[model samples]
Target chain A: MSLIDSISRPRAVRLPRIDGLIQWIVPLAIIAIWQLASVTGFVPTRVLPAPSDVVLSGWKLLLSGELVRNIWVSFWRASIGFLIGGSIGFAFGLANGLSQLSAKLTDTTLQMVRNVPHLALIPLVILWFGIDESAKLFLVALGVFFPIYLNTLHGIRTVDPQLIEMGRIYGMTDGELFRRVIFPGALPSIFVGIRFALGIMWLTLIVAETIAASSGLGYMAMQAREFMLIDVVVLSILIYALLGKLADSASRVLERLTLSWHPAFQKR
Target chain B: MQTALRTALPETELASQANFAPHARVVREERLAQTSGLPLTIRGLRKSFGDNEVLRGIDLHIPAGQFVAIVGKSGCGKSTLLRLIAGLDKIDAGSISFGQDVKPEDIRVMFQEPRLLPWARVLANVEVGLGRDRASQDADARAERALTEVGLADKRHQWPSVLSGGQKQRVALARALVSRPRVLALDEPLGALDALTRISMQRLLERVWRDQGFTAILVTHDVAEAVALADRVLVIEEGRIAHDVVVHAGRPRARGSVELAGLESSILSHLLSADDRT
Candidate 1:
């Protein structure tokens, strides 16, 4: 047989396909049990609002445009903070990775600073920026920067030296060497940084918004708790869950698109 | 023979003799005049790593379009010699001169590993050999032609991860040849292949070398492969040339013929004896 035919030929027996409904079975069953318990008074609705009540509250907020407006506000803050932090991190990574002088000058100081929890700086940030957007932006940016910077530096440091030698032998100038070999070799790690930073971005925003902000989903949830509006609080939590899942899914899609050439992603 | 005379002398004496060899210079110049491609000349090449001297005052001269193979035991510095010639490393002492027509960028080396960029398609990886000026429209066409030469034109669009070992090496060969280099250096390029695939690749390499007419220097430990592909085989021992044999057989020679086998056994014996001395 031909090589490609031998490799590409299917070996496993065909299995029946399920259209992913199997995944929803358990979550639906849990919702059904919860709804039954709430209606039959097995569990009091005051302590835990019914899923229907949470949905109704979400719909009310949506019609009033409060939910959308808060979401927009939170999204922009996260994006701005992420962009500023990610850019700085990427630049530092490239600098430290390519030059030993830069690494010697900055790497030790950065490592020492990164160990301190960024959230611990919240009080100081609030003191410095005074409850404005700057405080939340500073917190989120601090949280996201370390993962990106460290991973980018690691990725560049770990590229195969043999490949670099190959690039040099093939007549690539120093700039060409960086662009063709070093940058692409470092990209997979940078993507890892991006995904991790995105998670940290949301987490830091939530803390920052809750502590000081008057306008975001975290603030809404905090206000609902104060007023004993359990449905709206549950609704806010659900919104965060959905947004987190959406962001993670978006990262996965980006990974698939950029890393189609990678072997880890090629196995079906 | 000159090989016998050179091997009989100690390395220090040989290094001194090489400094005053007027006859050798005349021969080298005549060879250069007759050759169409780049000729390589190395004089008293020496390299050391910390305390372990890898190559000690080695000298070699290769005429253009000549396929020369260097065979030695592991750590005998054959690969190091090829690396030095390919300009991948600096020489501690010696002069290496190429023909006037040849630029430093006109030499390409292929390692045992294919070393294709995992993030690039086969064609794009081959086009990398064309250097940074890949914006020209002809870059793709030249890469496609090289792929066709290696019988991998159909596989150009596929990722390097999908290629088989032999196929990947062929892609590497395509990349090395895409620039139409005047000199090609192979550092055990087929060492990782299976026995059968290795034979086929040897044939393919021979065919490519014949058609391209580039000066080819191959560093291999396999004695049979050295005999099968090289016009002249130099056996390196303790960082110096111990035996130099010119194969009298012509191209398309039978693989299992007694003449080739005789040469292979003699080279193997020389290698084994060199091992015994160390």
Candidate 2:
């Protein structure tokens, strides 16, 4: 049959559990081996804590609610910065993508600005906004802005011309054309931008907090490092990893919700 | 509100008051036993993309409400001609003069790709053809009627991704017809479908055109489709009309009928003859 004739063809594979287990087996085995080595005293405890030791530290932190408090601070700051910077970037990116005059005027300036490291603005941000919440937020926002802007612009520009023409022919106004044809068409790329920006926001927050901060997971880690409380340092790192994973998983859920109707996500 | 604006509705509305009632001002014409509703006149319409000339000194007239198919090899400017008529492409010179009071919104087009918004349900895709304001105000009601017209009322909530190629095209057709455009232009809308699907879509298109009485201009390279769906087929050669054939076969045409096949063969022969001359 031709490819077109196979539109309704039945899927052949059915080993969904096998596919799931295939990914988990190696990671679980590695963790088990590490725990076994620690128990056997193959390595010194000072160098690497057993998984059980880390779990104990985690439990203590959790009981005191210190872990949650620190994490909450980091999460809130990242979210606020992401929302502000991302919105601004999204608007500018869309303008650049849609109009030739805007693209011509802004493309060069955007590229030049994007090349400058956002982290370098730390001292200046601190000087301008002080070593307060605003300074840390400004740093995080600057770090996130470029990825969202660049990806959103790319997404908008790549929307199919044929679809835009289809909208015009159907008596769609400019606003309707953008909403119905352009926005949904650019969604997959826009999600990519959101994901990238979220990752950067976390990274920037860590650096910004490590430099100067009274509360947050990054501040705790920096304080722990000074006293050589390696367990606390490891504990803080673990917390950061868990928090990042949670944020990423939430974003993935958002992506699936928005893009379930996309062709790429449809079941064969 | 003014008293006239708040006046009570009439008990029995006349046909003239209904939205679908054909306008009386339209002067219908006949060519080769087929009805032609209006004339699209273009005088010296010229366009060029930088150094490359796409349409050079083009002048043509298409009778209104007639099913006219434009056929040409790729880059022969057949699609360009359709775009210009639909007002999608701007002309560098001259002007496209429509029949009196011809509004820009009265033209609709169906493209080769289904081009349905992935986020939109099948019904919403159909409703996209309704102007943005209308689609926004009464989206659910308008989408329902359009989906019902396309025999897909049950699939109103179904995503476009789940649709088969033929069903997607059906949604696209529903979108084109929902707004009741006076002129419908199709650019190989059925070309991407399987042969069987294309045949069925051709019949569906013909039925809609006859029932709705909308003028259609189809741009295609398939001789069979040109003969089957069009009232008059214009074979464009070198950016100009070379042969214009009036297909005499009546509407509700069977896909593999001997009469339909004969007309298809005649067009094929004409295309070959033109090819030889070129």
Q: What are the clashing pairs of model 2?
A: B37-B64, B38-B64
Clashing pairs for model 1 are none
Give the Å shift of residue B228 in candidate 1.
0.8
For candidate 2, lDDT tens digit of each residue in A1-268? 1122223534476476786587679868977988899899996778877877878877888899988898889889999999989998898889999988998998899899889999988888888987789988888887788888898999898998888877776667788788878887787788888888888998999999998798888898888778876777778877777778777779777876777786545554
Place model 2 in a CAPRI quality band: medium
Which window of ten consecutive residues has the lowest lDDT sum in model 1 chain A?
A: A1-10
Could you give me the TM-score of model 1 versus the true structure? 0.90
- Cα-based TM-score, every candidate: 0.90, 0.82
- Docking class for model 1 is medium
DockQ of every model listed? 0.55, 0.49
